[model samples]
Target: MRTAILVDGGFYRRRAQSRLGEKTAEERADELNKYCRRHLYHHGKQVANLYRIFYYDCLPMDKKVYHPLLQRQIDFSQSDLRTWMYAFIEQLKKKRKFAIRLGKLADEQAQFLLREDITRKLCRSALQVTDLKEQDFLLDVSQKGVDMKIGLDIASLAYKQQVDQIVLISGDSDFVPAAKLARREGIDFILDPLYNPIKPDLFEHIDGLRTCDPHFNPNWSEKESTE
Candidate 1:
């Protein structure tokens, strides 16, 4: 069997950071490659040949944006996030059988909003508007063409019969239609949410649910330790 692994980059990064802790760009890239390869095997046996790993993400916003809290123009182009993201992408490009698909940030829709916890506090009357600090806000931006590209790739892979199995590393229900299409094409659709809890409705759309997180999979951790 041939398997193609598709990753939602933003989702993966967030989950990885939360579960595995932060790492340098190079380390993160290596971890991502290792995680994806683990899906090629099951129960200590290789079940499928890797076709390619597809990573979809948007470039960080590079334009200057006025910060309402800081009362200054922030140049995102020089931000550490931009630097780290570029390095990460370059590292991924160097990995064998990796395809990087980049979407773009919606510049016009970019704005800052109160963080979730802060918003909740304000709503509950525990915090006042004057209590808001610069760190209490986060920049919100929309990613354009990411979901569309993922859907298109799924369709293309299914139509071309390029792989017998399609493993999506995402928790988003937005791919339900794409998953349904792949299944109709006789492809096994697997979902690896990295141990994240997904909606129960998502289970019916996938052929299998699995994750290769070392923290959760003892077999994986044992294999790694031996290696």
Candidate 2:
């Protein structure tokens, strides 16, 4: 069977950081490639040949934004995040059978908001306005064209019958319409949420739900230990 792997890059990065620990850009790219390959196997045996791995993400914001807490203009073009993101994308480009689909950040909508914990503390009067720190705020940037690109690709793949199966690594329900279309085209649709809990309604839309993260699957680790 031929298989295409689609990844929600933002979701994957967040999960990987929380579960797999922090790593450099190059190391994270390598880890992502390996993780996608694990889905090509079933019950310890190869079941499909990889068609390609499509990674979807928005390029980091590179515009200057006014910081509310710091009361200064922050130039994201010189930020470490922008540098690391470019390096990560370059590494993915060098990987065989990898395709990168880049979306863009909505520059006008970009702003900093207090973190959830910080917000709660302020509301309860546990913290004063002066207690706010730069680190307590997060940049809230909206992504554009990512979901559209993913949906378009899924429709194209299904219509062309390019692959027998398509595995999507995302937890968002926005792909439900595309998933339904793929199913009608007789393509096996698999979801890998990386152990994130999804709504029950999502179960009916997928042919299978699977995650290849060894860190979450104890059986996989046990088998590896014995091998």
Candidate 3:
């Protein structure tokens, strides 16, 4: 059967970075293709034919960040770390059967709040800091329009009968409506939520559930759920 795979770029990147560690972008590109194809394998037996891979993400914003601890303004977009990301995306573009869809990063500023546990510890005198001269926080960046694009594409493929099955690599519940539409169109819908907990309500909409493997990131916190 012809299968089209769709991946949430942000989700994939965060999971891979946390789990796989730092591999050169060139190396990661190779692994991305391999990782997608592995899903076609069932318990060591490979089945189905690939149609294409759709990767959805927005570019990092060219925005400045306020570092409370450093007490300075930093241009995050120009960081060497961002250059590494740009190089990685370039490598992904060269892969055959891979389509990268770009979205926009929200321009509004976001603030990072300390984790509740950390805040509690500080209140209980269990947490201490050597430096009292500066505040501590981080800037959070978010994406916009990515979900709409994903849903539109899913609808397009199903309505056009481009593939027999659609495999989505996202944990977000926002795709439930799209999944329902695909099923109504007679397309098999599969989901790979990366072993992250998925709500049963969301789980019931898909035809199958699978992942390339478990998350290798050993740093998951206690509050993270498997649902």
Instruction: List ranges where model 2 is wrong by over 4 Å.
Output: 216-227
What are the lDDT figures for the candidates, one per model?
A: 0.92, 0.93, 0.82
The candidate, 1 or 2, that scores higher on lDDT is: 2
Better of 1 and 3 by lDDT: 1
**Per-residue lDDT for 36-108 in model 2, tens only?**
9999997899999999999999889878999998899999999988888899999999999999999988989
* lDDT string, candidate 3, 127-187, tens digits: 7754323334434667888999999999999999999999999889999999999999999
* Candidate topping lDDT: 2
Cα-based RMSD of candidate 3: 4.8
Between prediction 2 and prediction 3, which has the larger TM-score? 2
Clash counts for the predictions, in order: 0, 0, 3
84 in model 1: Cα distance from truth in Å? 0.5
lDDT at position 188, candidate 1 = 99
Using alpha carbons, what is the TM-score of model 1?
Answer: 0.92
